[model samples]
Target: MKSKLPLFFFLILSMFFSACSVNSHIMFKTKKNEVIVDNIPISPADAYRLAPDDKIAFTVFVENGKRIIDISSGVNENSAGNQQINKTDNIQYLVRNDGQVELPLLGLVKVGGLSIIEVQEKLSQLYSANYIDPFVQVKVTNRRVIVFPGTGGDAKVIPINNNNTTLMEAIALAGGITERGKANIIKVMRQTTEGRKVYQIDLSTINGLKYADMIVQSNDYIYVEPSRQLTREILKETTPIISLISSAIVIISVILTLN
Candidate 1:
């Protein structure tokens, strides 16, 4: 029985090494010498276009925002009345699946695939028939992105309030990458007209500054690959098994001595 113990321990160790991977917690892994797509062109001019199911805060002003300034400055007693009306109008409008949003004057206008500026212009044109010098404002109230900053339980859904929020800005909003994260292995997964496009970004050097300014769109996923700690991970995975084996060995020794 004592001679068989060596074989038993060897079998257990073999199973442990085969079953557990030291870097199992790491995600979005790439193969060695794998071709990563990183040539996606990006610039500040590339604004975030409105998509279906997006909620927007739509507002229209007359006399080129004269009423807006009056209401803001409290110019007269009429400001109170305007303020009341503004409160009633300050509500979110949903863009339907067919890329149309129902507005006050315009029943169902196509706003999807258009930038916020474009939507405002389109709405202003449609409302021009009814109002004088109509000024339109459209804001996507639910624009956000998911970011995994290379640490477990450290992911965040960051809201994009700015029109040109960059990749670096989004990371900053998510508290930047954790110490265990690899700066050179950042991935940006974006949904394009063709399909889902994955872009690899390397921000570890000065040359990577260009990608730092890459504007992020709504619902994009940013993942930072984590550095693998082989020794620590192996110990963590094997501690319980080793403890159990040690306990069993003590029990077996006591039984053999009693015998």
Candidate 2:
């Protein structure tokens, strides 16, 4: 009975947390999931577009087989010198605004928003004047994104090259979901000078595109909330239950004898 007194308290506490638990996944849905819920009211992805200050890497290959690479696209003058040194086959490039990259032979060419294949073709066409059948491969290198999951949970930072980064890729970077992590109703808090905007990303109904492995963008912040596991697991065998129960019984018997 003395031991169960602690068990009784534990059960009561667990119930308290369960009562407070909220099903937030249904509350916040990704733009895609929301539209599906409400009969496809609008296309949300259309609103998402890349902007400046976005980190990207660029790679350039010349006809004679000189590969020029530039990372940290925003401001990397060093890349020019590095380009002159490396004449190998692999060159990674970061996209520069004014929508172009600096090539040794073809100064600057517009490359923003173009797919990798399109960029390669554009570069080949520009370089063909001097070299025959140029081999060009373009990729984005600094696709770095930071995820800050506050209140709900922890934060994580992720980086990418050219390709779109997904959601799960960000989570795995933070050591996977914690015992306290919530899978369904996680909230995404996005920050900007216009003030922070809170968006709901429901993992449960996010069809096709998986959230955990979802690709992230440059400077993007992500948050994962603590699941009720935190509250429930608290004081739950944080100490050995057998030892705790034995101590409680001894103490109770001593008090009974003294009385």
Candidate 3:
């Protein structure tokens, strides 16, 4: 029995190492030789374009928003303008799968693929037929991204209130990366027209500052890889086995004593 004890413990240890994966919680792994995409251009020139299913709050005013800023608001001659404002203000309008949104009088207007400013210009031109020098304000109300800040139970769904929210901004909003996070192995997964595109960002050096400013889009996933603590993880995985072995030893000793 004494000789068999060493062999039994060896077999259990082997099984534990073989069956359990270390750093299993680490996600968005890439091949060691796989080429990762570089920093995407994120500037005013490459602003986020509207996409399907994006909810927007739209508002329009005549005379270049004269009434909106007017301290003593005068009654407008065009009751239709007031009606249109009432129909859209503070109400969410969904962009359909076909890239169109249902608007008053305008019917279904194509808004997908256009930026907020572009949409505003397009709507202003369309509403020009009814209102004089129409001013349009468009805001995307439901732009958000998911962030995993390098630790379990630290993932957050962050809203993209700013149209030009950067990767670093999103991380900061999620309370920054945990102490166990690997800043050099951050991954940003974005859904593109072709398919899902994964981009690796290294923020450990000043040279990586360019990638840090990469603008985040709606539904984007930012995963910060957590550093592997081999000793701690191995101990955690072996705790149950240790407890079982201890219980078995106690039982064996009790049976022998009774005999």
Which residue pairs collide in model 3, if any?
none
How many residue pairs collide in each prediction? 0, 26, 0
Model 1 stretches with alpha carbons more than 4 Å out: 5-21, 31-38, 44-47, 63-89
Taken over the whole model, the C-alpha lDDT of each candidate is 0.79, 0.51, 0.79
Show pairs that collide, candidate 1.
none
- For every candidate in turn, the CA RMSD to the true structure comes to 4.4, 9.9, 4.7
lDDT of 1 by residue, 69-186 (tens): 2223323222346664566346788999999998765588998899889998998898788766878777889999999998978999999888689999999999999999999989
Candidates 2 and 3 compared: the better one by lDDT is 3
TM-scores, each model vs. reference: 0.79, 0.46, 0.78
State how far residue 144 of model 1 sits from its true place (Å): 1.4
Regions of candidate 3 where Cα sits further than 4 Å from its true position:
1-19, 32-46, 63-89
Candidate 3 has an lDDT of 0.79
- Residue-level lDDT tens digits of model 2 in 30-52: 46433222221112232233333
- Comparing candidate 1 with candidate 2, which one achieves the higher lDDT? 1
User: Judged by TM-score, which candidate is best?
Assistant: 1
